[model samples]
Target: MSSHLLSRPLLLRHLPSLSFPLSNHRFRPRRLSSSAAVRPPATPEPAVSVAISADERYGKKQIISVTPQIYEYILSNVREPPILRELREETSSLRGSQMQVSPDQAQLLAMLVQILGARRCIEVGVYTGYSSLAVALVLPDSGILVACERDARCLEIAKKYYERAGVSHKVDVKHCLAVDALNSLIQKGEAGSYDYAFIDAEKRMYHEYFELLLKLVRIGGVIVVDNVLWHGNVSDPLVSDPRTISIRNFNKKLFEDKRINISMVPIGDGMTICRKVLQY
Candidate 1:
């Protein structure tokens, strides 16, 4: 069994000490648009290796976590796609580093799009555009993916990815706070138009995003939210961080939300997959 369950509880991870000063060791984004928490570049490890082992440290049956070979393959592909080699080099030159959707995650998203035959998609965060590319890759030529990105700096990187992947025609980038972008789209009669929506922007707005997404995504469409675990602190009662509490509360609400069928997967911090079951 895969030891690393995506739904597994999040734990605060510690980094190895190095000459890089403490402040320097911190994963600070060079720009505010770097929405993802930057981690140390992954060292090449054995293919399909264990990532997190569920041992008896807690005196219970453990789950052995493994990073699939596909993950490494995706990293390798991203590191070497020929057409976009120059664009990627420029992206790194501008962004200072690479942050992308793992190959497993990319394939997972793509499979969903293809299997569900999603012709329209909405993505809340564009980041380096990996997620958007993932969605667009499986879409029909007529499909459209609307991506909301507030940071022009990061969106620039995303644009390159879209171009390199030859999917720019399928993606429309909206530069604005996600909420405003969604509000305007709805105003323009884009409501209930999306077959799939992925939400991964600012955490505190998850609830609001859901409300807006519900209107924008048609009944029977699905909405996916990332980072619901917030690095394992969602259960810490004493910690009332707005983002964490908001997620925990959202999870609670989803469980009781008869309007949609939900499955919170333990994938990449956590992905709450909700398929709208009720027509508004």
Candidate 2:
């Protein structure tokens, strides 16, 4: 464990931060030929509102709300692989489909996997396998993913999609509690073997999961915790729901911990990226 976990510097040398820049050219609509009949606009366009709400402006930075038009624009720009599209559509019809990660989040996860050069990963909650598929699709042929999901039905759906995506062999589905599975891995001397671990399981167990994952992952490995915002409930003072409270406290603990560096990006609910920087 010491030798494996202490290889942080060597791993860090292989990984670098990545960025993508958008095209600078402004979009322009093309005019139809005079020979073609001009079509009338079907709906009257609403005036663009300049007024921004308090929630729209966080501190000095302003962020646009995900309006229908904005969502359409985003969907039009991001390319979704056919297998991912099919799996997403199928998951949309299932009960509690909202639990599945958004396409943008899926894309981000894939990029993270590639940037990290990750081969071994762990998904704490595999809800129909959208995220699992996303990460697995980007991993190398010899890569492996340990997917933990207690729901057998959900695991079945995930397996079917994984097979269709041609990444079935890369994933090992574990139908058991996430804590149990993570602990079992540690007990079997698999600590510091995983390159990444994603936590989207029971909210109350997030802290517990983090503790276990911190010990299991190497110093350079990353652990991404989803829904850290708890649907905008974490920061609300009046909202005292158990889950919300749990997430709020967990976020505080994560912020104070020195073992990992954190960036709580406001994407798809909220994703807290914790990169291990110190050995346990």
> Which candidate has the highest lDDT of all?
2
Every candidate's CA RMSD: 9.8, 12.0
lDDT of 2 by residue, 39-128 (tens): 645984332223354663554444344433344355445556777767776877787887888767788898989999999999999989
In candidate 1, stretches whose alpha carbon ends up further than 4 angstroms from where it belongs are 1-100
TM-score of 2: 0.79
Clashing pairs in 2: none
TM-score of 1: 0.70
Error of 2 at 239 (Å): 0.2
Candidate 1 positional error at 136, Å:
1.1
Writing each residue's lDDT as its tens digit, candidate 1 over 141-214 gives 99999999888888887887788788899998999988998999899998988899988887878889888999
Candidate 2 ranges beyond 4 A from true positions: 1-59
